[model samples]
Target: MNRFALNHATTKFWDQREAVEACARIGAGIGLWREPVAAAGLAATAALVRDAGVAVTSLCRGGFFTGGDRAAIEDNRRAIEEAAVLGAPELVLVCGGLPDRDTGIDTARARVAEALAELAPYAGEAGVRLAIEPLHPMFASDRCVVSTLEQAVELAAPFPAETVGVVVDTYHVWWDPRVFDAIASAAGRISSFQVADWVTPLPAGVLTGRGQLGDGCVDFRRFKTAVDAAGYTGPIEVELFNDVLWSRPGPEVFAETVERFARHVA
Candidate 1:
């Protein structure tokens, strides 16, 4: 059977302890998140997951290459350190949007390149791989400027295979016409594969209104087969950020997510 994992942000409504416990009880073996890990106290959360036999698939985010300032760079470097503390295998990088809040897409791309040059080496040394997560083009203004699998691969081209790679999330790049080609090109370099459905017309641009498994247009089985063909045998993590799921009890949401993941992708 295909393994199902949860992104911590999907269960942000719950405290870290509750979310971790719920995932453990429901047979979930992977987790992806950043802030909650800090708040949960790295050692405590690591021990909890360890006790429950859960796997920390990848951390939520570490890159925000815009701002063009020292502070932002330092913050991201700290994030890499935190990933080491928690025994996470990958640090998801949502490279920043336009620089200084006024730059264009070209400037954002340049900034990300510069930041990655500095950060990737450091992260690689710590035994942590950096997974560059391309945000949807809808987020090109305030979130990640790297908005496609091809773009992400290009950005990671200069780095060693172990130092940089891409996180292929369905919600972000499913609509791209070149998705199949990108996925094929991404063989052996896909650091993570996140699952989420893209719903239409979101009011707020950031915190997802992502659809549930089988509720939206993403063809998970097809994606799984492609990734498997690419030799990426990692966990296919379910990463939703829906208001409706957030309002429910943590355990209920976790169990439902696991069941739906099996029904749709298995």
Candidate 2:
């Protein structure tokens, strides 16, 4: 399906050029990561994707605004520019978690709002949407403060939909009882839809434990139906972060991911 996409993180060890070529061969869109793009050089990466005729659906991340790090803002601006160069429409933002001292979730969330207010206009100028991604609560203390789709929508409300929006990742929001309602409320503000099943016995880092499509408990059909009902007709990016998958051959992993997506999500 044209709507099925592969997020680069799914094959973390794959060479970026090979990944692009693979997507081209399969006629699938690709979601890219900044590290590999940087390793390949921005202009070169852009040329490779353009030559391969693979649509760049979205960029991995751009936000980490909770600590009041000035460099973070500048880095996000650069990421926006990179997304534009790659023809990606959205730049995913994982708004950072609490600072080291004195602040709690409320303060962290407030800072995210402030950061969005500052970055939204810049993203609009770059023709890239700042997509606020709500990581799971387990990551709220160290990785992200935006922990729910509802919070993401509220944080994005003040900004124009063209400039700021939210990311709907099944792995992060499946546990939220209000997720369906949040998806409906997101409506036109949904900038990206990422899929990754959730598995237990999380690893030491808990960063690469995402399950393959049917191997976990997420209800993919329901999420797909809900997002469609919310008027989101965008690419469905499969973004599993699994160490086991990364240990396999890239082509094998990619093929298996596509088959699983067809069976469980598409």
The candidate that achieves the highest TM-score relative to the unseen native structure? 2
lDDT of 1 at 230: 83
Best by lDDT: 2
| Predicted structure 1: lDDT | 0.82
lDDT (10s digit) by residue, model 1, range 1-266:
34677888777677777777776776665665666777768788788888877778888788777777788789888888877877778889888877664687788789889988888889898888888998899888777889999999998889987889899899898888998889888887898989998776674755668988888888888888888888898877888889888888877777778878889886
TM-score of 1: 0.94
TM-score per prediction, in order, is 0.94, 0.98
In model 2, which regions exceed 4 Å deviation?
none
**Model 1: residues >4 Å from true position, as ranges?**
none
Worst 10 residues of 1 by lDDT: 199-208
Candidate 2, residues 72-159, lDDT tens digits: the string is 8889889999999999999999899787878888988998999899888888998999999999999998989899999999999999
